[model samples]
Target: MEIEVRDLAGLGEWSAASALYRSVFGYVEPEFGVSPRLLAALHENSGSVIGAFDRGELVGFCYGFTAVEDGVIYHYSQAAAVAARAQGAGVGRRLKFAQAEAARRTGARTMRWTFDPYALRNAHFNFAVLGATAIRFLPDYYDDGSSDRVLVSWDLSGHVPAPSRSDEVVAPSDGRWSAPDPPDRVTLRAALIERFRAGGRLVEVTRRGEQAVYKFREADR
Candidate 1:
């Protein structure tokens, strides 16, 4: 599979990217969907709207914008999605690296994003594959008490270090990537929140026997 990663421009491309985002995430609510107009505006600004193509067909896309926190400028990746057929083909990673390169060119040294804590696959990709570190855990990040997220920061300069020994661990039930049972999910969520509040930063996800364990280390003060 020959995947081409590049910047997306114009309404036609934006529209296609927008539709692909919605389709990949199975988003039906209008409020959850991104508009082509917004994409155009972001592209015009110092924001990144990157897409992965297979023979000119859009297969994956990611978008982010430059943001400042405490006077430190960084890129905040808003969302990224890959077509089901293109997943596991290295398309998502390509889109992210390309996005990081674009942000680096814009004078940003780091990129931040949020992901579901229960998605072990995503955790492995962010921490193990991309070498990102999770600094904060936001319970019900969307204010709906349902969308819990963990905020991660990736060094655009590729200077992230290997994870050290974990001070705490959150092991998934039955070795599953996600907790589908409501009670189990709630328990794991609480565990992660407690660990984060105790000043632990998630550094890696590793397998211990049959379980997938999320490893966290105390953040340097």
Candidate 2:
């Protein structure tokens, strides 16, 4: 499918972009949906909002803004959504690439975002395709009954790492990724948290059949 991506600038674009979020997220009502005014404010303030279209229909979008964390400025991507029918078609990847390019033009060097660690496909895309490193794992991040997340950071000027695997089991057969080892879940969580706090980075994620293997390396000095 031929997809067109460009900057989103007005209320008409926001209307479609908001609807795309509602559709992909399966929101039951408009009350909990993202509003066009909020998108407009983001567009006006940050100029990081972008959209993808298929024959004039908005099929996907990604937006972020520069934020200060630890006294450093970087792009924080808040959200990106693609229509269900158009998913797995590389639409999200294109949107992210566009977002990165926009960020670079504005003098930002890094982009931060979050994703569910249990989703292998997401893990593959973030680590393998986009070269993002999982720096922090937040438990109950969404409060959707143990739906935890991993905060990912992508360096705009870097390249994807070579493929590798970690001997440690990051996820079990049941797909409960947070519990790497049933007997020492608490210890594993603490270790991961401490590593990131010290600036560690997940260097590679290699899929082995039904399992996704993770490899972590020490923080770069």
- Candidate number achieving the greatest lDDT relative to the actual structure: 1
Candidate 2 residue pairs that clash: none
Per-residue CA lDDT of model 2 for 1-221, tens digit only, reads 78999999789999888888888899978686888888888787765889998888889998888887888778889899999878989999999999999888777889999987656667778888988888787887877665567898899988645544333445443353434555555555565566566666765656565455567876554
| Candidate 1 Cα deviation (angstroms), residue 196 | 1.2
Give the top-scoring candidate (TM-score): 1
Candidate 1 local lDDT, 1-221, one digit each (tens): 78889999888899999999999999999999999999999999999999999999999999999999999899999999999999999998888899899889889999999998777788889998999999999988999978889999998886746545567565554544655678878787888888999888988877677566788876765
Stretch of 10 with least lDDT, candidate 2: 165-174
Q: How far is candidate 1 from the true structure (C-alpha RMSD, Å)?
A: 1.8
**In model 2, which regions exceed 4 Å deviation?**
29-31, 159-167, 174-199
User: Which ranges in model 1 have alpha carbons more than 4 Å from their true place?
Assistant: 161-165, 174-178
